[model samples]
Target: MSKSVDRKMSRGPSTEDIIEDTLPSTTETTVDKIEEISSLEKKLVRKIDLRLIPWLAILYLMLSLDRNNIGNARLGGLEKDLHLEGNDYYTALTIFFAGYVIFHIPSNLVVKRLRPSFWIAFTMVMWGICSLCQAFTHNAAGLIACRFFLGTFETGVGPSIPLVLSFWYQRDELALRVAIYFGSSTCAGAFAGAIAYGVLATMDGAHGIAGWRWIFIVEAIPTIILGLLSLVIMPDLPSSPNKRWLTPEERELAIQRTEMSGNTDKQFFDKKQFVAALTDLKNWLAVGIYVGLNVALGSYAVFLPTIIRDMGFASLDAQLLSIPPYVAACCLVFLISWNSDRTMERGFHIMGVSSLGALGYIFLLASESVGLRYTGAILVACGIYPIIPLTLSWVSNNQLGHTKRAVAIALVSMIAQVFAIVGTQVYRTEDGPRFIRGHAVCLAFISLSGISACVLRILLKRENTRRNQTYGPADVKDLSTLEDIDTLYDNHPQFRYAL
Candidate 1:
């Protein structure tokens, strides 16, 4: 054995030592045990998918609806009803993100302590109440206040999904799962448009409430109900003693898979982990990538209805037309994310899709054709939507320690929300018709996001090369032991980044 291997063995009980001590010992039965464990792992993953992914996706669907329904409401005469003037409408959209940015890191830090199920459910209930309250807003001030508080309540939902998924899935399994969850945003956009179309058309002035008010009231009902249901349905960590849904063997297998994938077992918040995440160059690079992508995301989510309206479609038709692009985006995100996982690549997928978004913007800038502009819209949706889950999973995959991953994810998301504040302001009323300025800004940011992905990929590749030279090639089977010995997360010698 090498001197480093000898030192690792001498320091304390390796993960292998613990596993050997705990597991059944029988030389003739070793292959049988391995086969049994593999079967159990398959069963566990299927259970996790059935129980976890659908509920999370539904929750995120509500979140996306509550967040972006303002755009739909605007088309349904919210601005006229509230007497919104000048930049008041845009300011309301922008202010929500201020609350969103403020609470991300703090909310994520508390997830483990408070437990994800309770914390997520509580926040969902609060956001649902806030969304419902939007129906009663009599003025721009009232609307903005509801939006800000809604942002505050909904802060943890987005970042927490990826964090929770990381606990259950290996790195390779994460992107697709995240895509499945985040794809709900695209679905939300489509669903919101369809619902808004029906509500505005059929429910206008019903019970003396405007169509816009009905939109808020009706959408808020499902959100509030699901929030209540989540308390019972959502699973906590695999290691939680209270997780009655998981069999003892299944729970052990879940924890074992995570550890074997090189994720640390640390569950509590650590200041040192926070500091390491803050200081990491890769984390900042991820922040840059997310900022650019989210700027485009924030703009599209909030303005697609208005942008479609500018294409000479009637208000109702505009809302309905918005659904197709998001549908396209939703379909494309699954395919792209599945391919990303199948190939074990992230940066190129991000860069390529972001470039597709930029091209869509270019088509918009260069053409006056309605069909071409609509196609541009589809491309833009396809480009930015998938990149959200892909980039999020990329950051989660690279970060090892649970606390560090939590902090790093929150920090990256917070910075993206900050940029989203700016993104919201880009589509000003005065710049309407073509909204050339908004398109240009989105194109520029998308390009920047693609560039950031390339840089990050190259940097990680170089680091992986250097680590291999210094410590030899990583042994996939020995990751659990390496994780225990290397306290520094991804900085460990045996940790090879998925570039």
Candidate 2:
């Protein structure tokens, strides 16, 4: 008996072991059969990216070109031609924001009420007309009128993009998509330089038109054409019936992917969320971050060529040198946003970059080295540009409902545009070359931005930690119903801020 038992044990369970090995366990089959939903999301995201990003990027490129061309036009002797004296030039720059700031909230709400494609495209054509009008201006008052209307129509595109992207992309995916189109604004800077050089150099006297006027005409036509093209290309929100491009299955997946991230409300307008957006502390904090960025951004856009010209370069060389900083900005904007998305982090990236912007101003204020000051200019662009998208996406990320997100995005934009108003005023005609006051003001605000970002991050992290412990870390499945989801908003114990 002992010999038989020893032989059986030595054979390692004999036939039973072989039989069990031949058949997979329940766990193994489940593991093998389990579907990867994220792969489908990637496919859908790629599809959305293809259909959306390119056209939007082109539109933004033109929008930015049209918006920032005034600065480039200044180099082409726009002020002298228009007889803009004293603060008149700054007033023209500042008035655009008046319309821009006033219309932001209304336009965002209007976007919700109208089909996004129709609304956005309509604005594009209108703004192009306004931009075209700038070419016909004979005085500062005429230019200011064109600029104000340009800002009014242009508002429907620039600040509204993040809100539109939010409807399609999840928080995890929002930043990069925001960067791509927004980054084109930086590309617009590069293009602005290159185009200004081209228009001023060759078209100075063409068709009996001044080169500055030529700049407006050349940039405005493409905008109108692209606007018409967008009707055929621009997509509506996934839930919108206008989304003919999406199949039923893919569309559902698109909606589902976004739903997994947060509230995917069916309503185009939510009064409650609108009220919440107005009242939310986060929106105001986001405004602070943006105020800082806009001050730097506004000054940088309108004054760079002048600053470079004051640095002893010829006007054309100054235009050419402006191209490099914008080129660097284009690269850094994409990389920073890519990394922000990759890590699912917003604040530290914002804080770090704002500090980098402040340091750039430091370089400007601290040293008179042409090389150092120029490098400071580059650093400022590299630093300031990335934060715009990051902060917009951050506000959009935290807001739970469509209306809230939309309203919050606009509110933050509306308030922040005021600083851009200040930005135009910062680099006064007298403050050429060093522009110590302008540089110092930028340094202070940008530094405030970095600090604000740090504090916001710490506060968000603490809230997230508290929720994780108390509510036990909610996931997509936690709030089982739409009612449950809508009511909770940010207060939902499971909702975590994208820190």
Candidate 3:
């Protein structure tokens, strides 16, 4: 009987043997363990988002300083020294935007295919050179020419940084990061004034250059050096050798998560898709909001220093005064953005803050008191600056796929600049020493932004409901690969549009 049983065992598998054979293969188990480990690693890595946030914020701080310091210089007699008259100063501002508008989309497209280190750094270096040239401008034409080139090179910044962040963080995490980076403009506004203060007070004619010239030359130096350092330090994408922050396992998880979320390498810019995005009423709504908001921005960027200087202060003192408002603005921007991220809400926060700007402009227009006007200016600075970052983030969060987002970003920015052309012309010297018309125009536009934000919220909610009833997409999770995250645009049909 034992021999017979042994023969049967050898001829056919027992239940125990079958169960053993059904267990995972060694290779399969190992792969499973690797995947589990990889996932754990990714969760660990994403926790340190703070580290990257500051660097990006600082980069933008410098960008804002470079871009708007001209206002400070204007207060320090740049107009007088350069012999700018009538509308030359405004012309220079407009020329800068012209170049900025022309090159924006191209810069973004190039950055998509190239390493940010080279393109961003190269842009920084070029803009720095242009900034340094401002110290030597002998007339309005030279300043305008330099401003034009400066705009051309600096165009890489406003769009590329947010796009770059999208490569590292997911959508829900982006608003605050965008705010943090955008908040640096507040730092630029706050600090540039102070720096201009010291430079003007101590070195008005240092090295045979005017104080305004010194401001331009001194500010450009640090930016150029930082641009070079960024080349070595800024992490490339996951496939890059410099990507030490994310382990290979983590990278695979990143890739896997993105793919599972429907962020595949599909071309997002089908002609039909482009037409759909373009004709979408929501995109146009965003355009109108951004345009109005940017008009406020353009006016502030060109006139903040002048307004401060007009407030019973010297050129240096005006620069010093400019700091506090920006500092306040930065803090508020961060607070709002953090709350937005925490709550997974955007439209309300954006609209609420933008309305604050309208109030600021109204107060400034109505009051003759310096203190009241100054308070209003602070509110204006805070309110106006946050909108662009918030708007960009909103668009980015709402859009799905890369090409569509890229196009959307480019479209919003270019159109905003088109409005900026109009806004830049608002604060003519003829209207200054109290720009009543400019203040009124700014208030009107800020009101426009508020209305648009509310309208957009309604539109998004409806769209989200429609999508929920249809495809039932997932929610936004991955920050870096936002372009591929499908759930953000509301794949689910029922619970859509959390505005």
Best by TM-score: 1
lDDT of 1 at 291: 90
**Model 1: lDDT of residue 383:** 91
Residues 1-499 of candidate 2: C-alpha lDDT, one tens digit per residue = 2323312211111222222333367666442233333444466778999999998899999999998899999989898999998788888899999989999988887886787888999999999999999999999889999989999999889888888898787666788999999999999999999999999999998999999999999999999999988887898878767467776867886665556556557787888888888988777778888888899888899889998888889999998999999999889999999998777778989998998898899999899899999999999999999998899888887888878888999999898898888788888767777899999998888987888788787787777777767866443342224356686688777566777
| Candidate lDDT values, in order | 0.86, 0.83, 0.72
Write model 1 residue lDDT over 1-499, tens digit each, in one string.
Answer: 3434422321222335335534677775485666665567678889999889999999999999999999999999999999999889988999899889899988888887888899999999999999999999999999999999999999769888889888888777888999999999999999999999999999999999999999999999899999999999999887778667888888887777776665655647777778999999998988888998989999999899999999999999999999999999999999999998777788899999998999999988889999999999999999999998899888988887778888989999998899988789888777877889999999999998899999999998788768767888665444566644446777877677777
- Displacement of the residue 139 alpha carbon in candidate 3, Å: 1.7
Task: Indicate the residue-level lDDT of 263 in model 2.
Answer: 51
* TM-score of every prediction relative to native: 0.94, 0.92, 0.86
Clashing pairs for model 1 are none
RMSD of each: 4.3, 9.8, 11.1
Q: List the candidate 3 regions with Cα displacement exceeding 4 Å.
A: 1-51, 260-262, 266-274, 469-498
Query: In candidate 3, where is summed lDDT lowest over 10 consecutive residues?
Result: 6-15
lDDT of 2 at 31: 28
Q: After superposing candidate 2, which stretches have Cα over 4 Å from the reference?
A: 1-38, 242-244, 478-483
Error of 3 at 447 (Å): 1.0
User: What TM-score does model 2 achieve against the real structure?
Assistant: 0.92
